[model samples]
Target chain A: MPMLRIEGLDHRWTGARQDTIRVGALALGAGENLFLHGPSGCGKSTLISAIAGVIDVAEGAVCVAGRDIGSLGSGARDRFRADHIGLVFQMFNLVPWLTGIENVILPCTFSRRRRRRAGNPEAVARRLLGDLGLDPDELGRKTAGDLSVGQQQRVAVARALIGTPDLILADEPTSALDADAKTAFLDVLMRDCKAANTALLFVSHDRGLEGHFDRSVDFRDLDRGGTR
Target chain B: MIGFSLRSLWNRRFVAGLTVFAIALSAALIVGVEKLRDGARDSFVNSASGIDLVVAPRGNPVQILMAAVFGIGGTGTAMSWESFEWLENMPGVAWAVPIQMGDNHRGYPVIGTDVTYFEHVRHSGGQPLQLASGTLFIEGQADGAVLGAEVAARFGHAPGTVIVNAHGSGDVSFHMHDDAPFTVTGVLAPSGTAIDRMVIVSLAGFDAIHAPHGTPDADPLDAAGLAVPPRNTRADHETHEEHREHTGHDHDEGSRAAAGTGEHAHPRGRDPDGHAHAPERLNAVYVGLADRTGVLGLQRAVNDRAAEPLSAVLPAVALTELWGITGTAERALQIMAWTVALASIIGMVVMLSATLESRRREFAILRSVGASPAHVVRLILTEAAVLTGAGLFLGIGIFILAARVAGPVLASRFGVQLDTRGFDARELAVLASLFGAGLAAALVPAIKVYRATLADGLSVRI
Candidate 1:
């Protein structure tokens, strides 16, 4: 079974009176990197919200780690996501008040399973940060708000991969970086994700990132043709 | 969780401090009022309990009580010598202590009374005045005076040291009886009463300083009745002339003993000639009734006196009335304090509410990181709890600091001893209620965070 399996997923925001997101089928096997791209205004945001269990899934199955998340309640889905899927958001979403390592340890604060899996979570975070080119002293020293864009992006990637979740969802995490830095950071992020044997779902409108992934797909290919 | 909350608040310490200060000021106000009210009432009840009645020229009872019992405000008017002589010798009158005030020594009011005052007056918990050192002034010992414990301790006045009297009851006086300086004969033990702030002198001491020319004017207010012996014929008497120039801090040793012979010459075994010069007036008098049941009859008799307009007030009744007057003022203060406290709670709510717009992204980001909506709600509530809890603690700190700085000054200056240690049950209840109310206010914003639609918050458009 694949690490993530999606089939016939349909979600509609009740107040908006339109289907914000609709998907027929998608799958990513263990350790497979899929580059999903689309221009602005193509329901990429809706898919991201749906994948994170933030919005309700009207119809379909979102199976992660072999368990269908659509069958779980709101709280359970949240717990399931925390335990299995690591989210790397678009804009380097590190909690500004925390130091870099503190931000990486945030997911473990929410999930006991991740805390147990990390085995001395601080040590693991330091090692993963070291792999992602953030020095040990810098991880413990600088605040997330004080770090440069490239440094903050690396820290965010380290946070998502900290507990080695089965699925890594990178939502345009490199969009803020310069072209040279983007290529360099993607190399480190892919190397770390492949080492952990985690499937990487990289979403970005810029197709330039496709070269770093094993396969790529346009987000509109999976959209259900309807009043979306 | 608390650590995280503190860090978040630390980022906004300046704004947080303003909130804490607002809460602190209101808390300190209520706390100080409660303390002062409790302390004042206790002291007033303690000192006024033993004295049954205060008989004086008819006036505002609160004013009379303030002037006579508390030695506050200005002096009261004098009644006739006939009234004092009459009341003392009355059937139900156990004893009467005449009190006269106009002169002050180093800011402490000087009250002139006979030794009967030392024998009759009682203070805190019904304790009588006891000499801490030296003896009570002998009647003929014109220069002898006694000091209250605080006056002696504060002014460093010891027996045999003479202190010049200022002409009025207030702290600063333009006129001083430098030639009529009274010798400090003794210091009274600390009675924790109003007397601790008084200077007790012989009634003769009171009259000598007020006498016009060393020839005792029995009633200066009614000079027409005093048959002044032709001035030169009474040249042997201590003339107020020799004392006139010695004003302010200057004093004349020769005039010190001369002033004592004016009127209240007590224990002075003087010739019948000296007794003839008795002062003809008295300020308020403390009259002790032989029987408690006879009080109403005596009060009615004093009030209905055909000879002079006089009124007698029961000490307890008058003091309670005073409390009623001040209680209104105190209640106003409490209402104002509580309003400030209400504003503080509202301020906390508004402060937290103001952050919701900006913090939405922080909340959404937490949700994306697998934090349930409930977690977001908890984070906001936790921040509120910490805010209020810190503010309450800060308020208590401000109160303790004030009491430490202000308690002793009040105790020494006003004879009001405040207990600053711990909260009484009522005070604790008030604090607890404030705590509850503060957290409840914080929940308004917490609930807002909980019910927030955070889906768009997590998604990036581009």
Candidate 2:
């Protein structure tokens, strides 16, 4: 089964503009990397919200690891997300008060399934931080707020990859980094995704990093019916 | 969840600390005010514990109690000596001690009574009066005086110190009875009552100084049908000799050694049953009944006396009436205390709500990490609980410390003994309610965050 599958999805904002979003179909297989590119404010975040089950879709189904999350209640949907998926935002990703390892092990705190899968959450968190080229000993001593931008982004990646969720969602995860740092961040993120055999859905407005992914798609084309 | 909440609060420690301090102060005030209120009531009630009734000339019962027992206000009229003799010999009367006021030494009330005053009167849990030094004066030792613990401590008066009497209870008295100085025969132990501030003297000594000068020494008890010879002729002549010896010196330092003074060498010596110099009038009398059930009957009988207008008050009933009169003020103080606690809780609500605006992004990050909105609500409530719980603990510490430090001063200066046993059921209930109030108030901001859209926090606005 695919790690994530979305088919015939439609959503509309209840405003005077009544803007709408539509997607025909999308699927990400296990251990695969898919790069989705779109301009800012092109309903990309709205689609991400729908895929994450933050908002119920007006039509169609969103399935993660063979379970239709759209059919689940709000509370159940949240549990499903915690157990099967991980999300990394572009900026301000870390809960600034938590230490680096605390942020990485945060998913396990909410999901017993994730905690059971990870076996030893702290060890797995430290390994993930080390794999992302951050010194676990040094980073664990300081709060997430004390880390530099590049270091914080790496920690965010480590957090997403900690429990080896079925799919990793990256929402412009490397946008804050410079060119060299962005390239380095992508290399480490893709390598870690492949090692965990976790599917990666990388969303970004930048297209220069497109060649690093296994598959590439434009969000504008996917949401063909979306209006400004 | 608690870990997360604590770290978030610590991040904003400056504002959180202030909120905690405000809560602590209010909690302390609530508990402190309660302690004092209870203390004052207990002290007032306990002051009249052993004595069943207070008999005084017709007046307000509370005023009569205040004057007779507490030495607070002046007794309006002096009942005639005939009425006191009648009350003393009345059926079912266990013991009666006459109290004559209107004199003081160095701001302490001078209570004129015989040895029965020491034998019958009790204070603070039915404990009888005890002497710390020397002995109780004999019945006819008219020049002997007993100093209360506080009076002795204040004036540095030991057993042999001679102190001249003054006319009134005011701090400053111009009518010094230098010719009628009395020797301090005993010093009473601390009683934590008005008695601690009294200078006790025999009724004869009180009459000697107040009697009109140059009149033949008269015995008022003879008019009350007790045939006793006039005995003050010899007492007056001895007082005159002592006045001459100490005329040029300070009266307070008259004779430090009772034996050395040689002035007490007299022929009338100690007359054990002598009522020879009893006064013509008495201010009030404290009475104890042998049978508790006879109190109401006796109280009515005394109040109905046709010969002289008198009021006999059940001390406990009068105390309850006094407390009732002050209940409104106590309730006002209590309401003010709770209001302060409410204001502190409101301040906490404002602080939590204010921080919610800035913490939107933080909540969004938690949401993105699969934390349910309910989880966010729990986090906020947890923060409130921590603040309230910590405040309660610190407040109890503050209350106990303040009580320990201020207990002695309040007892000595105001006669209010604080109950310092920590965290009684009432205090615990108060603290628990405060915790509940904090959580209830915190929901204002928690629910706001609960209703917020994930996109509101996830958006790049912050």
Candidate 3:
């Protein structure tokens, strides 16, 4: 079985009359890196949230690490997401009050599996941040709220790769960075996830970085195929 | 978790501070009311100690307590001397000490009782009577007096000085008996009781002055013909020549303390028992008891044997009833305390509820970082607990400080001591309830955050 599988995945926000998603089957092998690009309102963020088990699936199955999230309760889904998946949002989504190191260790606080996987989580987070060009002082500085946007993206990449999650969901992770910073961040992200055998679902509206990933899937094309 | 909560509060310190102050103000009102209620009870109990039954002419118990214990007026008719004697002789009676009020020496009330009073009367802690200076009245000398601590302090009277008494209650007097004055034979030590504000003369002495003396401004039937002249009249006379001549000779003669000699008495001796030189009618008696039980029985026994229409009461009962009468006002104050607490809790809820919306982004971040909804809920509750607990602690501290700073002033002004150490269980319960309600109030906002987090997914609203 692929590390993540989607079969006839469909969703709409609760209390809304219109369907926001109708996607055909898709599958990703372990350590696969895919670039998912689409126009605004094409449910790119919604598809990433589904893969991360953050949003409830209105129809079809979103299976991460081979377990269907649609079958899990809310609490179990939360725990499953914490243990098996690492997500990076368009913004860093780091707790503002926590230090950079503290924000990086937050996943480990909730998931013993993540903590175990990270192997002395602090040391792992420090090494990852250092490799991503964040100094020890930057790692100890207050969270994304205090960091520049480029720096925040680098921290988010390090955080996503910290626990070697089975699936890495990067939601517009490099949108705020310049081309050079984006290249540096992508190099660190792809290299780290590949080394840990983690599948990557990188979402962005920009197609400039499509060449960096193993496969490129247009969200509009996928939705068209699933609807037809 | 604590760090997070602290940072959240620090970020919105202004709103949080108002919530904290609201809780604190509520705490202050609740704690203050509790202290005042307890203090009033303590004052009533303290003032009513030692006296088992307050024998009086029939009236309200609270009124009787106000008059007898605190010296506030509304004189129930005096328990007649005959009634007092009868009560003292009752089967269950230990000692009946009549408190004869209605006369003033300086600003203090003049109480009349027999010499046996000194032997039997004990103060709150069972401390026996000790004279600060001089001796008790000579058993038969109706003209001798024992000055209360305040009276003694006011007049600078020692064992030998003859103080012209002020012979009535209120701020004015009707009669002036300049011809007679009692020799201050003793000064009592500070007693922290009504006695501290009394000039205790013999019942016979008080009686003598009130008798119909038939002389202008004098009661002729009174032994020794000694009546306290009105203060205004004395000031005028003292400003005149004849007063100087009288006072000069009297001062010298009284200062002569011929301790072992009765040799200075009148060269012509009159009737014995010194009825010729003693007062005719007693004011009231002071009762002392060997055992405190059967007080009601003793009261009944006294009333049945009385010649005049009179009533007997337990001073404690009367004082308790007086305090009970204030129960409605006290309850109203307690309700006010609760209302303040409720309002404060509502304020905290409103603030917390308002802030919860802003906290959605934080909650979403936390959830994306893997915090459970339960964890977020706990963080909110913890913040509430911290704020409410701090307010309660500070409120209690304020109460204790205010009571300590104002204790003596209140005692002197209202005769009620505000004891700082007497916090009751009820107050503790109120504080705990306030804290509990505050925490509960935070739950509304907490649930809202939980729902927002689930809906927002990995996306932080901010």
Q: Identify the candidate with maximal TM-score.
A: 2
Q: State the lDDT of candidate 1 residue by residue for A67-115, as single tens digits.
A: 8777788899888888888888767488887899998988898888888
Candidate ranking (TM-score, best to worst):
2, 1, 3
Q: Evaluate every candidate with DockQ and list the scores.
A: 0.46, 0.67, 0.58
Supply candidate 2's per-residue lDDT for B74. Answer: 75
lDDT tens digits by residue: candidate 2, B103-209:
88877789888888888888888999999998888776778999888888877999999999888778788878876789999999988787888889887777655
Global lDDT of model 1? 0.77
Candidate 1 residue-wise lDDT at B446: 83
Worst 10 residues of 3 chain A by lDDT: A219-228
Residue pairs in collision within model 2: none
Interface CA RMSD, all predictions: 1.5, 1.4, 1.8
Best by lDDT: 2
TM-score of chain B of each: 0.79, 0.82, 0.72
> Which predicted model would earn the best DockQ?
2
